[model samples]
Target: MARIASEALIERLAEWGVDTVFGLPGDGINGIMEGLRRHRDRVRFVLVHHEEAAAFMAAGYAKATGRIGVCLATSGPGGIHLLNGLYDAKLDHVPVLAITGMQETSVLGTGYQQEVHLDRLFADVAEYNMMITNPAQLPSLVDLAIRTAYARRGVAHLTLPNDLQVAAADADPYEHVAPARPPQTAPVYLQPPGIPRQEDIEWAADVLNKAERPAILVGQGALHARQEVLAVAETLGAPVVKTLPGKAVLPDDSPYTTGGIGLLGTRPSEELMEETDVLFMVGTNFPYSKFLPEPGKARVVQFEADPVRAGARIATDVPVVCDAKEGLAALLPLLTPRDDSAHLAKYQKMMAKWRSDMRSLENPDRDPIAPQYAISVVDDLATDDAILTCDSGTIATWAARHWTIRGAREFYLSGTLASMANGLPYAIAMQHAYPDRQVIAYVGDGGFAMLMAEFLTAVQHRLPIKVIVNNNNSLGQILWEQMVLGYPEHGVRFAAPEADFSAWARSCGGFGAKVSKAVDVAPAVREALQHDGPALVDVDVNPNEPPMPGKVSYDQAKSFAQAFLKGQPHRAAIASTLFKDRIQRLGD
Candidate 1:
């Protein structure tokens, strides 16, 4: 039987090992929908409420499994909705394939109904972007898109016109050149495992050996090199500091590691960067230069897979371009083990104090539940191998500090792009990838509200993921940012009659609970986790509570004071909250 281009495309995707496709259907993609129907047994189509969520789910799936994720959407606005999530995948360097339907080929130049110039729109976000004009191009285009996404570790895009999608998948009769292989045949593409130069390894080792206090910084790029990173840290008696995306690279319990670094990071990690004389960065291009050591103060060594990013963030004395696992493995054997424990011990002590201080702030006795306490309860209740994802906001800070990554647990967030509304979708993807494992989303009220409709998708699929909402009824992070940036809080708070997130979950055919008091946090979280299917626990947290930075500069303090003097809304409540928190910390 002769097949249409859409069916051939699905078959080609199946051959490329794609088991699932996350997307929303539309009129422009009727042919694709039929193809999916025909191949339902071989491929699962995850219907999403929004195209944006589909993109995020695809990116999340790729991140969790280290495989290419595919998301599809119809033409025009649907394709436009996918940009933010695609950019998230691009910035984080995750491989994702995005398929969009376009208006018929006859309307290419003319602005037909729902006709979007998708090729130009996706140019900046995609590593490879193309439109399939002929049925014959579907097979090769799909192959190229997948290979390019894998090779670049970013988003790849393909747009198929409505008419061309249903056309017969036969070569054009007028074609002049003969092909080497049949049109249906796809050549397998495998990325070579990168190996670093011996001299580069020796150079990195020499730099590490020469310094009295060396530090190791890891990122998502070094995720697969856990043992190698730990081994090198131990050899140099160095403290390992992770970027937020690399939080699970080493279990937080590891003796050689300090936690994350940056405004949302642990204090011990801040100190590690400040005191180290030599900094060995493993597969990380951490953006904030201020959080890094002074340019000339510390000699830098970077190991990265992308050569262009080797010395892009910080000045590098030695740059080793190779895969993180391979580079760290080779350099480990060349390093001389140090007997000094002073550097590692110092940070370990600092980490202990930080942990203690954090615990003090997690006060369960507070009238309105402390957000930290709520997250702590979830942390205590989550399974050993749970996959956790958090949205961008104050929730990010809370999760980073309180949630401990241990056992086989993995953590994800919008690390580089720092996009909101990603938590629920990421959780859904994680749940789909590992059916039996627990998947949880730690999201703020604002972020969750943005993509809250996705809860229905979770219920529709019978995904047993749990969502914990920090219901502050305000954009807590933005309010704090306004204060610290010398601006009065404006347009951040939600109107009265705060959302009943738990009720929404229950309405969507899932378990729901609301926790108003601090004491009820643990029981509520435990109940949600124990539920048979999807669940959401909305905790009414203290809105005035601030996500205090690891190290507050004098300018920041002055600006915060300035904002208060400038008549910031709810100034008195914020001040009272701040004063009480300080007194509590002092008493602790």
Candidate 2:
């Protein structure tokens, strides 16, 4: 019988479907490292400078592939470093399993060297936590951890004591457990009792039968129900407007499809929402209440999977609680068709006009480089199948508004929690998971500097990722807000001398370029993309320039004007520029 030590553990991991594990080596996990060396052909180990980056890499792999991401680390500080990435995985609903080496079992409570209660330390981040003191318990615990990670769609932690890992055990005593398969649950039908009443259905049919203008609002929930949603949109002769997160629910080229709506939204959708009298919301819980127009003015109908989410934000005259696909299927059969040619034409005109208005800001003649134009250029240069990861801040807003994606591409952002410094970590993970796909990180100077150390992780793995830094010396969003609202800008600017990020990238053994002029952007990007390994494009943009075609309320405008009038001398010119183009009237 062979000993159920660290060597055998790596064998078990390979058997259980772990192809890659990310971690930094240490003394306590030397045995495990040897085992990894033995199985180099079957399982590859990704060594990162920080355990936190390892955890994040695992998360990115899991999110992209829907498989459990695994990471291993030594006890004490190494184990502790995994906390941040684990917490991020838990919050983002990614499956990850972390294995940590611990002190000998005999010295459990004797304050041994490099000793800490790892199970307790990881309790907050993991859905399941366990410590194995006996070699006999290793196989079962490993299987359970994998199962728990998949079941909960979150992180799981397992601690292995040094002594226990090398103990002899009965050979083949534990049977290899097959991976747990997902259950085949019954499909949810959209209809519920006492809802979509016969009278209501008849009235809705009447409205659809007589309506000349109707529009569809698609949300994230519609992604899984694309075919059904498209069918309903086609049947009703209605155009589609998507929420930001629902960008992929319908193809951008679909005839009925407009674009997204809100502050980061495009023109077509906003115009359709404004002109259409009847609006059907499909599978979206858009948070911005202000974007939902007056309920009395528009005849609103909503279909959703969750009952509580149906009318939480805005009043819905027609509400159906069911899956978006199921609801659309049922509603389409009951609705009557009507001529929407005139209505669609009117909104189409509005869309064209708004698009024209938006294009004015992207003119090459515009000075200081319009942020929107820069994003548009990046979008055009990116591959159709590229994966875009954006940091939270003004850069995220710009990327969300301008980045175009197809069905094969993915766009990831920290939308719910809105955390900064996620772009680099996210890019690292994406590169690790899909080496063939192009991965780009759109980040701001402040946000990129926050977690810049992880750039070493990319170099170590030779992961080819492109980092585009929007180096606007200040926090652009907050400054713009201060200029718009009644608040003086304080502590919103970075005073340090600009470090040559391109030089830093080269020093770190990666390709790098610096671009100050607008004409230099394309060539710099082309050069970065041609590099064989990690690359960076440090772009110095105008800090004084505001995001073009500024959209804000009248009250916000007045407050911003007041604040500017009473502002500091250094910012006087920028403040005056913002107020110079102000229009007093509120209506569009």
Candidate 3:
């Protein structure tokens, strides 16, 4: 109950339920470090080599545990380095509290050693940014920052001046702040001042009753409304198609759930949407507008939490601005139980056929190596409760298509940002946060190389993270796009000598292997899994094979061509790759 500045901060952090702190020590934050040492039994500080990795580690932990993940850094560059990871957490909506040390408060605006505008620099990435100048502000500021992070679901930065860390507070009285509670009643079901006209509900019910094949499209918002979504699907006897972000909202094996839709989606889901007369988009933005059927062809109904997102992607016959769960719950009672079990049965049959056909594409006999086959082998060798982190590009597509996620398993990725260089660090963080669970990173050569330096951090901590690099020596996604867009692929290839990733792993005092044939993949992965420390498996996969499962349209092809002609390299490549195989399939 002493009034020491560092102790007060630690006491406040403990009240916030922060059991683990990811960071390293520096002179500027030495007082806080000294306090942490004194209170070592109360809080555990996880040290990392780079401040950036520390922030990412916190982010991964927050995402997995659904709590505020905390990280700390010293003054100047140390604090600035945390920005990249903070930005990642901000974009992904992960709750993280980042505490950094600044130069002495006495030298405010004057040039001091390691002095920088830490508060202003973190403005864009943090929901709340404050520099604590007075000791009395510590308790309120800490409480406010924690509350803001939880409420906004983003990063909050707290900068402590070096002088403030040792400043004695006049009062040591600490008040506890309770965590935010989930709404008592679901937000969506609550009607505003004007009641919904009975006719509106009747019309929606009529549309459902008349349509022979109505498809349900679900997204991330469905996570909060799983029961409602299932209830609505069951009432209407409709097949549900989920987006990648909504993967586990419904059980993958549910008879009512066909799978994801769009470029990397399964054939049955795509076909079902194309054939359906009524498309109900629930809680999903589904960024690819080209994948959507024409609004006029199919009556579209949308339910979302935000009013602005109700009809952004497609024209909607009905748009409801309630929580996805609330909206579905309200609509469920109005719907008549359809006897069209046969309609749902047909879609189920088609889904089974799609799953069987896609399994054949994994070619265990391929010579160069199919990435999908490699993923299958890894899946087989991995623990049932393992955590899988995937990087962007071909590997992500392959993993999404092939990786089987059980209820016990946790899937973490930058799905919204779709950023590269996240796999290795993400795996390290997962291993750190959940030591008992096996953590694996499925990354491509391009992505792995981008954050290759983080491999040392894994080794330093002796984290048993297994990194599987799909080594194609090129950006596979870009190559597919170039072929589709009628452009000569340039700057996509890494013509430089390839690093021996296996040797690199060994150099860092961990297990490593280079897998060329399909037969060697499982054994290599098994060996890496058995290692006590970090490991890497560099698998050489076929560069020509496409990543996504489905095809694109003629309009998509045209858009890509226009972008390519204008020299928008990355955008053009994405457009071309997305539509390449679809164009070929149509031509045939």
Candidate 4:
């Protein structure tokens, strides 16, 4: 029995363990769409507003679930729209499969309607890009597109010609190809392939055993290695600092935790690294080299799974190319737990005071509401198993500091891409992936407005995702950056009558609210969280409140002064806040 290529393709996707696909219906993709309709029992296609959002939703799904997220689109423009989100997946090192339908194979180069060079367009973003024109290529291509996504941990693309999609699958019946690794849904997911060499582990242990002030820097890779990382930290009595993506690697309330260490990071993390004699870089490639201690200042020992990224950012004194968990577990036996409590004690006191100061900020009785206060309220109310997504901007800074993720709670930022408007898309995917779990998107007004149309998608699907809008009325982070560079802020303001996102949500068959006063913030958030369907809570935030950098440079200081002289409003306020934040941390 010969099967239709499109049905075979959909069956192949189902066989690859993909249950949900994010995409839209277009005429060029009708064959694939029909295939989806036929396979409705096995796969569900999530309708999205734009092809870009579909791709972003796939990326978000992959990031949150650690599975191969799939997205579909038509030829030309639709294929182009997938690029940005595919890049997000690629740069962040997540597994995603992008399936695009092409114009007929016969008219590929004839400048036909909606025909474009998709392979060339997707080349830069996808690790594996292929075209399926022949029925025989359907099974292997779909398998490779899926397995390669998992194996490479990046984007894999498959372009199907509309003509071939509905054609006969094969002269013979189809067979399923088993993946090398067990699916995440299986009774047992595959373990890491290898561990570090004993010599490498021993060398790292020797360095840790000798150092007085050793620290652990974590990243997204540390998620699976939490126990091993904690063991290593406990043995050395080290303070663990986190990258933004690594924010949930260790709970902030944990004994060794020191929040994060970048522009949006904490003082304790910065101090911990600056004072560290030995820094064990674990599973993170925090790109800001300056945020790290000067090369000669700290002896670096890196425990990385990927050999390419082992020491790509900083100088590696001892490089252990192995799975972080496995490597740390092996090194534990060779390590000696230290008795020097001074280093750990010093930062612990500072972290304690920092937490205290942050508490006051979170409880501020400011007019038009402080961003931190509402976010902190969210922090307190979120369930331990909640899935939270944050947009890129000053709102991200507030969320980074205020929201404390622990237990089974998961946190996602855009990571390297840092693109705006990702929060809502991410939340949509999260809600779909884990419908039973609580999903929240902390989006800025700027970011939310960019992809505001996606709210309708959430409503259409009856997804119960809570969206919290930080209506700052400006590109807050960029304004701070401009001031820091001694340049007057330009094109940062959203002129006149702000966006009423809550009203838009209600129009789309969902609940909505707008909160401006301090008193209404918590209740609005609480209401949104408790809503049975998709909801949006829009809260007006002070535009002048800046999220300052961890360590100010001489040039940055000079620039701020110049901007102040140029009559930049909030100049003194930002400086005063920065000074107070640092000065108050000195006592502890």
Highest lDDT model number: 1
Model 1: clashing residue pairs? Answer: none
- Cα displacement (angstroms), candidate 4, residue 523, comes to 1.1
Q: Of the candidates shown, which would achieve the greatest TM-score relative to the real structure?
A: 1
Q: Quote the positional error of residue 64 for candidate 4 in Å.
A: 1.4
* Better structure of 1 and 2 per TM-score: 1
C-alpha lDDT of residue 279 in model 4: 94
The weakest ten consecutive residues by lDDT in model 2 span 579-588
> 3 or 4, which is superior by TM-score?
4
Candidate 2: misplaced stretches above 4 Å?
A: 1-16, 28-32, 101-118, 121-124, 165-228, 237-245, 251-258, 261-263, 266-338, 341-347, 481-485, 547-551, 568-588
Off by over 4 Å in 3: 1-3, 111-114, 169-212, 224-228, 275-278, 281-283, 293-334, 482-485, 555-588
What is the descending TM-score order?
Answer: 1, 4, 3, 2
lDDT of each: 0.90, 0.73, 0.77, 0.85
* lDDT value for model 4: 0.85
- Score candidate 4 by TM-score against the native: 0.94
Weakest 10 consecutive residues of candidate 4 by summed lDDT: 179-188
What lDDT tens digits, residue by residue, belong to model 2 across residues 368-433? 555656676777788888888887777866776577666666777654445677788779877877
Residue-by-residue lDDT tens digits, candidate 4, 114-172? 88879878888998999875777767677667767776779999998888888876622
Model 2, residue 480: distance off in Å is 3.9
RMSD, one per candidate, in order:
1.4, 6.1, 6.2, 3.6
